[model samples]
Target: MTKKDDIVQGEGTKSGGLSRRGFLGATALAGIGGATGLGSLVMTRESFAAAAEEARNNYVVHPGELDEYYGFWSGGHSGEVRVMGVPSMRELMRIPVFNVDSATGWGITNESKDVLGHDNTFLNGDAHHPHVSMTDGRYDGKYLFINDKANTRVARIRLDIMKCDKITTVPNVQAIHGLRLQKVPKTNYVFCNAEYVIPHPNEGSDMENMENHFTMFNAIDAETMEVAFQVIVDGNLDNTDADYTGRYACSTCYNSEKALDLAGTMRNDRDWAVVFHIERIEKAVKDGSYKTIGDSKVPVLDGRKGSDFTRYIPVPKNPHGLNTSPDGKYFMAAGKLSPTVTIIAIDKLDDLFAGNLNEERDVVVGEPELGLGPLHTTFDGRGNAYTTLFIDSQVAKWNIEDAIRHYNGEQVDYLRQKLDVHYQPGHNHASLTESRDADGKWLVVLSKFSKDRFLPVGPLHPENDQLIDISGEEMKLVHDGPTFAEPHDCILVRRDQIQTKKIYERDDPFFASAREQAEKDGITLEADNKVIRDGNKVRVYMTSIAPQFMLTEFKVKQGDEVTVYVTNLDTIEDVTHGFCMVNHGVSMEISPQQTASVTFTADKPGVHWYYCNWFCHALHMEMVGRMLVEKA
Candidate 1:
């Protein structure tokens, strides 16, 4: 056939001709079907150019080009921090913190058990808020702190190493929901707020009467991660929502004193924003009298009783988010139960405290109605704020100054625009621009549901993170990323600002680099995995290689406290090993050529299998040993 005839076959063409039917047959032979079997259809140049532009916009990556921004999101109920690349919306890493990770053997090795801080009371974690380290009121890219809602602890993840280096489990605190790292004026502390109220240390008070009481942990020594002190917040303090650290130094002079807390109740019990004066609270802790809840004495900060120092301002119903502008002139909060985003003048707070203005009369400075169920609010350096609406599944952009002026009878437009997200959106993080002159460009909306948005794997669906472009006049929904677990909040920073460490030195204490140190610590690779029994304590020292644990069997009494020290024999990085004692609630990571230890009381007498969880070799599944505990 002629070439022109073969190229433009219409109807009644011969066999093997380039007609529509022949093209369809060819595509069928190549296994192309359904909507994708459109090779037979002709496309216009304009349509092709549009499709090519979309493909280019959604391009995964260049050969060696790094992402422009880094996103650190909280892995709720997973007890880990998920790291992703912005604009690209690609998941890069998952740092195990306060959780059991079989991939990296976290909490499954001796060293990681210490990192997990497991005790007689077995517990997992639900990470809620992930806050990036800030310096001078902006992301410093040095560390990220996340709070475990289930276990009531805080983990400090070193950005350089991309791993959790420190975990501070506070005593006498329960349901820690909010964590804020103070950095604007260089106050080295992380403020953690508890949701539910518990009795003072060693007290068994009735929860009904104690519902008004709350505890806040003062995690000092940010460089070292330590709980310097604990303070009592006496009020009908609802589940504390997000906190904001003001940029300007207040009367207290320290940046920590000006921390504003959104005292919100999930049950919509009260509507008040509590302004904490850290300096006064610190003084009360130094010379404050204790009050007895039931039997234990707690330093309760009751402003009515002159025991604490905190001022309250009435806001809308059920405020879920609170943030300060870049200039520290205004504080914004979103009421999930109400559609309005309330903006409170920071300077007017002093008037409210001085009794010049009453909450019922003049509490709210500016209340601009936005959308249904606003949960979080983030700022771009330019007088604008973006808030997430859960019920509406959208983000509303508004001008902070316009909201303030609207309340002053200027009749200005506070809401600039709104962009729809997939499913139910929860919290959001904008590109780092929480400064007076920052030009907020992008926003990542963390949603709660992703039904029918991606391929279904099981009953539990992955959450969706929608990337929105806000550089133009109107907000644009650009991309959708699927996240497996429930993500609560995220923090974004420029890629160039981050400096991560590729690997840790072999001699690190968490992963002993030298055999001499392991030997000096009584952890030896003796033949048969020597077990030392002394009274109620039993210690086993063994070494691990690929697909095998040198000591395959262990025996202990039901009441005995068992300590297993496992060392990795391999010298290559990433060829790590893990020890997980099934049903005993014991796990640890033994890094390559490193040693780690895990200790637990074998209170139950049963047969258990301990295995390597790092997936190091083909026979990694068989790298298990028998563990038996007999009745004492």
Candidate 2:
């Protein structure tokens, strides 16, 4: 055989024919040529420039211009809110909210429980609807509000630290889906609604012949971020979707009288967009005509006592989203099973609320057909509304100018242009301005499935977020961000407008005081690690020191109430520890020099072990303790 043939076939020794280095060099040259040639190859200067431009746009971030806007996205069942930078399309941070995130020791940390706190009955949650605080209807960038549907709670995340500050439970509510911030008409309360039907307040009713009421909407205070008042409604309040506050507080309702069968599907004819006259409820509160219920003493509005506080505007299919215009002249709603978006004039609602129109029927204005399964609508300040089509995986841009014209009886159809997205899209939100107007520069489309769009990530595919450039006439797909878990909803605010801090003060009581100084200040940091038993109440102050828990064992009797106060003795920064008791639904974090506590009832007798879940030191696994509970 020839020398080249022998070398290629590996029939010749390295010394007899081609050396290893020479063979590798020859193969690399041939491989490069073959790669460039391909089956049929073509390259041009224009093509090269276009390719280079696309790469630069996708990866490059100019200095001093970090990010134009910040998009707060819900992490769904992952129980967190993902903070992403727009334009750059970079994930800035993941703020843990309604779940036990072991990576950051969020729920595992003791002090973090003040934020992760919820009913012991629920260990996790489906976090949805990340609504930022508004000032005069504009994104204030101070506080962000998100709802936990699974746990039935609302959490307030302070933007300064990018951490959850407080989590308030919604008593007697099955699921919380609709959450929105309202600042207009002089009230600054975050509106939260129960998505599912439950029995009337204090009724002790069951599913069989249960009196279905919409229940009270817990209006959480903006400053304190607590559930302040509840606006109770009387009806078979089915699932409520995206809500807004403009001329009146409005929410889209699904499957009340129009039950979508046993499978809980969407119906095209029975859904509605309901408006609540919040002022009437405020008057009821002023007149002291409200009743309190449950341990929280949540005020409930007697549906039988007041004039009708709710007005229903019947729309097609299951309306999943509602968005008011920047001018507050109109509000748009799209149904999940319908092909159209119903646009209602705010003035018509005022007329209805004034009792000028009949209250027996739903107020219908205009139903402009957009696309199949239109799920959400967000307006651009440029007089256009973008609606996401879930089934079609496309976003339809409709003209609100034409919608208003059509409402004025001028024959103008509203659907303008439809842009294609990656997969099944859920919710789409646009960047807002001072007047709560959509900036029209960028629109984020959250899609559900990502079968072949990204790398094959096994059975559980990464969620796809399509960043679209809507600055020009045509919507251009700018970038694709692969995200973990399902992102249900998102809201955008300017990055420069909001402020965030990286570290807490070293002397701050909750997160910063030194362990030695705190103990000296008389906060009860006893080294003996005593479990004080007062009758059935057991109090244990557990301290952390590097590789071991100071209190290694907790001896308690069953049916005893146990309150464990956890304290961290570490003086070093970022050396936080977490505490989690298995199967007891107790988890919390203790920062350096800080103390946090968790309380639970030791109802069953068994030997249970608790450990530090935070991955800090090398001997983190060794920081464990045991709880021995004897039968009562």
Candidate 3:
């Protein structure tokens, strides 16, 4: 191999030494080469210049300006959801879902504990995917759902207040990894995939039986946060996606061999992308054609090998992510072990389900070779696809129509530009790619290993979330954001698509219970500053206007159970208040025009003071209240 070929292959190669740079060079290059030259040669120096200049204008969000797109990222090990501004890559907010945050008093507050169950639940979560709600293939922005791969749970956050309102644990399933929302008609269902296989009941009765071990495909009611049904499919599930028509939802099933060993799981030459008939499954649930398994009352349907509710399409080795194209034409299943992506036509799926198509391969329209370890695929509305080549550490940009033409035995070159990433990249998403209006303006590359990308902060390094301007013909990497731990997956939507309220509503359902408590005790939360004693419990009803609390002092007996409720009556925006009791492990947010409460035992209390932690007015430091704990 030549020096150029050596440099390319030294990185990685697949399907007979086929490197994207070398392939593009041998196909389109006479002499021009390298990153800059390849850009100019492909799109011509003049057009490339215009595209490059426009890309520079995409990222620079000046002071007092808002971003054009909102990015919802899954905080992998941290067990939270992070919202960042697209193009700018600036972290806007962190919505604590399954994780414990002492700063915002997420786990300490009674309001938060109501959402997070008070039972034997641990404060840990491994969030994998975050998908926004949709309406008829468009972002409705009502809610955002995220899956906890660590704890078999899913949590939904309200878009208006940007707080987690509900969290539901998926019974009879472990490791809820892949997650997606419905598309057409509305996102009525939130689909979650069970990654690990465990025997039902897990009572050690069938300890060594591999056949009894299987995972499930779960569909959750988006509004109720309840498990609607579970479909038992073949093998372990990895990633999943829904179609625009809302008739089908497909998941990539690895370990089709159903073996306990790692080598046995990868023994198959090809795995299956199991597609579920949503309408038929709904019918089965309605007709009571399912059975309850273990302690979970969730209706479980057998969609394994020969079930009519699901059809297993044989795909290349170890299929990973199942992504539907924006135009609703094809479903691209990335080959995690192989170097190609199998494109299955969505229109032919109806024929396969109707038994008109004899073979499962009849649904496959194209199997174009992209690069080594093609894990996930995203689309640009202009009939092009950008796939994350994991082993190759590159993003392959290819025309979808050209790939279909090339897969049809044409000699056309479907390979476009392949840009090198920092390290191993995983899931990459384009702007509005999940909705009908996939404008394809920007792309976010989530690189798993950020080696040498940022300053080394000890052994554990941050992930590299790179932003690319896909508005032009060539994809240009604009910014590199050093993210916390790992952000597994993310989705981008237009900023205008999401409508957030500046201040919390007084009648918001998030704190409706707290409001009801004040009404039960004949206390006006908006103006009352009353303290009532009931047995060994003290109810401190307080209000905050701006710089001072309405109840400046309240006396309670030591060793008494105290429930302090603080209501912020400020009607202005950005006047969020926080109640933090000194040395009491208590802190909670009370947004403007909102009421929040926290419960704690006054065991070792002397004269503990509570203050507003969030900055508000000039006398913010004066916003303190004393809790005088008398000797019991």
Best by TM-score: 3
Give the per-residue lDDT of model 3 (tens digit) for 1-632: 14333333112243335456555533443232342244233433334346556777756988878888889999988999999986778889999989888878898888889999866377888988999999999999999999888889999999888899999999997899999988989999999999988987788798678888989999999988889999998898989989989899999999988887889988989999999999999999999999998677899999988899999999989899899999999889999899899998999999999999989999988888877889999988998899999987888888888788878888666666776676789999999998889898888999998887688999989989988888776687667888887798998988888899988878888888888888889988888989988999889999998898888999999999999999998999989899999999999888888899999999875898999999999999999988899887
Full-model lDDT, candidate 1: 0.65
Number of the top candidate by lDDT?
3
The sequence of per-residue lDDT tens digits that candidate 1 reaches over residues 188-252 is 67766665555444355454454444555334457767665555554333223222343211110
Query: At residue 35, what lDDT does model 2 achieve?
Result: 47
- The per-model lDDT (C-alpha) reads 0.65, 0.69, 0.86
On a 0 to 100 scale, what is the lDDT of residue 276 in model 1?
A: 63
lDDT value for candidate 2? 0.69
Give the Å shift of residue 414 in candidate 2: 3.1
Q: Kindly provide the TM-score of model 1 when superposed on the true structure, using C-alpha atoms.
A: 0.72
What residue runs in model 1 are displaced by over 4 Å at the alpha carbon? 1-60, 118-120, 198-226, 229-270, 287-300, 303-308, 348-364, 433-439, 506-594, 598-632
Model 3 lDDT-worst window of ten? 3-12
Model 1 residue 506 distance off true place after TM-score fit, in angstroms: 4.1
Instruction: Give candidate 2's TM-score.
Output: 0.73
Clashes of 2: 7
